[model samples]
Target: MTTLFKAPAKDKAALEEGAALSPRFDGSGLVTAVVADSHDNEILMLAHMNEEALRLTIETGIAHYWSRSRNSLWKKGETSGNLQMVDEIRFDCDQDAVLLKVRVGGADATCHTGRRSCFYRKVVTDGGQTRLEIDAEPRFDPTTVYTDH
Candidate 1:
């Protein structure tokens, strides 16, 4: 697919200060996308965007991501009905990463596990034994929501 953005400028000053949306995709042709809830500024998930995914998200006002495991472009919450309606998008100075402020629809969940956010655990160290503990409750039942699972 043709890219909507030009190749990122090589000049450090231009890349950092210029008013452009030229994303500096990594070697894998992807940029990191950090998604957050627009309402409370809660981070929902961390995903990646290929050129196509980024274009689609910008054009559609919805979240789109490149699923590394699936190796395909994915529309966020397509099956789970928890679509992220993007309110704002911001990029870092170098444009290697993006921050998406979105409002979730439907069950207000963003995780395949039916949680509001993908980060539902907190790491703790008990006597040098590190473990992850659940920090959030599931907003919906995955078994009832995801038919293919």
Candidate 2:
């Protein structure tokens, strides 16, 4: 694999407020990523990426993430049929976060629960209690798709 451009050391001006693509990874060597649909710009999910995952995403034009639960690099929708083809990748001013606009294929789903987006639930405060309400139904049956999980 080709080495990506090295991130410059944290310099207040360059790191926090610059136009350069000098990503500031956290102690775990990971950066936060927010993904959304390219057409509608609907938020899909939030993930993390390591150096390799970030490099691969830029090189391949496919969304890739570092799975904290699995502790490995994962191509989004590798298991399910909904692959995300990156259309545009943007970094925050601090370069500590990324935003991905992607066109999805197959089921056009992004959540592991077979939902179109991971943010399918809305937080509601009812009777002075916080709760989640499902706003969207599953696009596909996760029980049938994710048999292993």
Candidate 3:
């Protein structure tokens, strides 16, 4: 079953050109990566993707991200079953970045902390002390959510 979106071209030149023109990570031009939701409209996450990760994501139809923390490529939902199935990919005007719209299957929430989104927390200042406030609760628990899978 095809999702409702168009996949980006797989040309090497197009991919390189697009990634190069993407917004810089440290104020220097460098296209990292992008991810969206099933509808191909809502942006789900923004994480860096190396060449291997990009290739794997494209070839496998699943989201693969370069883990700056783990220093390796990570396949989304490998452990949690919050798999992000790639629906489509598109490039911005400058071809320096791309947007991946995906369909998340099973009980997996997008956030590593088990929230529906990675942006679940909001910073709030209480009595001059900066604190994190939970924007929402987890849609499902990582432990029991994907047991059937």
Top candidate (TM-score): 1
lDDT of 2 by residue, 1-149 (tens): 77685665468787766666778789999999999999999999999999999999999998899999999999988888788999999988778899999999878888988889999999999889999999988888889888898
Global lDDT of each candidate: 0.93, 0.89, 0.68
> Which residue pairs does candidate 3 place in steric collision?
18-95, 18-96, 22-96
lDDT of 3 by residue, 1-149 (tens): 33322234366565456444332222332246677676635555778766566667778899888788777779988878789998886766645576888888766468766776787778999888998888778877766655664
Cα-based RMSD of candidate 1: 1.2
What TM value does model 3 have?
0.65
lDDT of the structure predicted as candidate 1:
0.93
Better of 1 and 2 by lDDT: 1
lDDT of 3: 0.68
Q: Which stretches of candidate 3 lie over 4 Å from their true place?
A: 1-30, 122-132, 142-149
Candidate 1 global TM-score: 0.95
RMSD to truth, every model = 1.2, 1.4, 7.7
Tens digits of per-residue lDDT for model 1, 1-149: 66689789999998999987799999999999999999899999999999999999999999999999989999998988999999999999999999999999999999889889999999999998999999899999999888887
Model 1 clashing-pair count: 0
Comparison by TM-score, 1 against 3, better one: 1
Candidate 1: misplaced stretches above 4 Å? none
Candidate ranking (lDDT, best to worst) = 1, 2, 3
